[model samples]
Target: MTTFADLNLHERLTRALGELEITTPTPVQASAIPEALAGHDLRVVARTGSGKTAAFMLPMLHQLLQHSRPRTDTRALILLPTRELAQQTLKQVEALGRYTFIKAELVTGGEDFKVQAAKMRKNPEILIGTPGRLIEHLEAGNLRLQDLEMLVLDESDRMLDMGFSDDVLRLAAECRAERQTLLFSATSGGNAMEKMVASTLREPKSLMLDSVRDLNESVVQQVITADDVKHKERLVQWLLANETYDKAVVFTNTREQADRMGGVLVASNLKVFVLHGEKDQKDRKLAMDRLKAGAVKVLVATDVAARGIHVDGLDLVINFDMPRSGDEYVHRIGRTGRVGGAGTAISLIAAHEWNLMAGIQRYLRQNFEYRLIEALKGNFLGPKNLKSNGKAAGSKKKKMKKKEDAKKGKKPARKKPVAKKNSRTNKPAVPDTNSGFATVKKRKNPGSID
Candidate 1:
């Protein structure tokens, strides 16, 4: 029953939230906003679609509004992993801070560098961007963060996974030494995350809103066994044809696969858009715009879209290829079932991908609902044998033989060494001190001459 007003947010921010119909603060927003308003560093671990963007943005905006500064240098910097996410955050900032006079600018790749530099000259009070392009701006002497009052690293884990650790760290180092830092991620990013937290935050308040295992409870996770790529393609086509969803996303492991799948879906007469790292920026924006406008019903993409794209009514996520890690799986399914909405996630598991799928399930500590499409069923049902941990059982013959030998108190038999042969003479070779080989020396010559 906690409202945005109860969190002591600025009147302008509360009014903006009211206009947006976001009256109640989500769990993350409720827990983080107060502490953030109190001027404490924060390291937040919340599920995706948990309103984390607003959680940090509201507090930063509230503070910025309460304290006015004459200088035009950027007071806040929000770094995201992808351009899409950066753009999304910019929209959120604009929506939430509409009533206030504070201005914000977005700096990311795939745009004119000179234009962005020109924008920097105007000195927007807030800056949002990806780390790579932002670092470039800093090096080119167009961007400065030494006077930044707040730094927010949204999707910090994904940034690390994309190998932005060095860039992020360098950016953090460039910021004001006493700036308040806020880090947000959906999954606990393990040791690397810990290291980054240590390096960036100071006496931070840790808010673990939910664990990875408990993410996306409203999403029904299921798997359909497939024989191969062709089988998966058929299954994907059938799902799109029959599934009840306003918008759906199909995730593949590689850009090549995303392109190929996009083609297949389009050929099946389904409205589809392909999004991957290789797509041009304009194409990416067009795909997203089309999806939001309902011009495209399906988006075939790589992990690039996992955390970047957000669409309402996106209630179905089809994993054409199983994600390589548990964190990636969480982000992919998170594309749907947002903000307590209901969604479905179906993964196509081929023979080669069964173990990887099983590993993800085990990592999440949850069993997926097994589903079968009777009309399009393929040869693969599942692994015949499974271990207690849900992994495919390995052959146990060798272990059984060892046990039998132990019971009989017998030492294992050793194979006799085979003699080395001289390749040229086709005769057994003898070992000597040098080079571990000595040929029969002149025996035929001795028999012929002496």
Candidate 2:
């Protein structure tokens, strides 16, 4: 029978929360908010979408309201791992503090620095930003954190996971030593993250949640043996075509891949949205927003898209390629099965990725339940025939390697890199693209007969 009011939050803030229909605090919010409000340097480990944002934000808001009015100089600082996350946190802060008079500014890349500098003239009571952009302002003397008393590192492990330790340290150096430091992350086991926290937080209290959010147990993790890149594409196509999935988000490792996948998905006559780093802010927003609005169901994205993406009713997450870390695996699949929802995560595992998948399994403490999607299986696409431009797998273009190596005295590499087979090895021999993708069709001879 406990609620936000029982947590000793200010009536005004509680009223604001009530208006948003947030009467009951989540486990994270209930535990983290009161501790944070006491200005204890605390570390919180909780899953995404656990109302952890408000756990820190409410206290930050109340402290800002109680201490001073919105000014032209910055006072409180929040560092988020990704720009999308920073924006999402800002949205929550803005919504909750609508009644309270507080000016908050967000600083991140892919935006006009001049415009942000202009806003800095108004001196915000709180500034939320990604580490890189925040560091830029701090270096340029545009971001003054001398007056900052409260600092929240939302998704701390992710900040380190994204290689932001230096930026975080630089930003911390700008703030007062006595300032409050609150760290929140889904994964708190990283030593580097801990070192960063050691220097920033003051006698921090650690609150860890019991469970990590994961896709439903019913929706098993399956890995398909993709011998080559093209086979993976075919597999994706077959899976998408056959599966009666309601909505799916496919994650690739890079921006180019996302764009390429977007085209392929669109050609398959599926509504697709691609989110990546190269996309302009507007385009990226439009992609995710449209996906959320149900205008697009298949979302093709990079790791940039995976972090902090909250889409309701997402049915499937395809790891067209997996990220190189266990933490990444957690965040990527955490996109699905959110808020007690059931969803599936499928990874298209190639030979080159076996080591990575092993590490991910070790991190999650569970091997991916191997399942051969029988209906969606396909052979690999390789440089099988004649072509000048076969791209190289190890060195240069696989097609070029296949072609040039054939014509001259140069010896060719082994057809398939050998690996020891483990359990679930009974599937048909997967195909590998030997030469290149350009010539999938049978080639007519350029007849200088051998």
Alpha carbon RMSD to native, model 1:
9.7
Candidate 1's residue-wise lDDT over 257-279, tens digit each? 99999899889998899999999
Winner by TM-score: 1
Stretches of candidate 1 above 4 Å error?
Answer: 396-450
lDDT of 1 at 98: 96
lDDT of candidate model 1 versus the reference: 0.92
Best lDDT goes to which candidate? 1
Clashes of 1: 0
Clashes of 2: 21
lDDT to native, each model:
0.92, 0.78
- Model 1: how far residue 262 lies from native, Å: 0.7
Separate clash counts for every candidate? 0, 21
For model 2, residues 163-275, the per-residue Cα lDDT tens digits are 89888988898898888998888876568977987888888898987344332465567777687777778888888887667778889998888888889888889888788
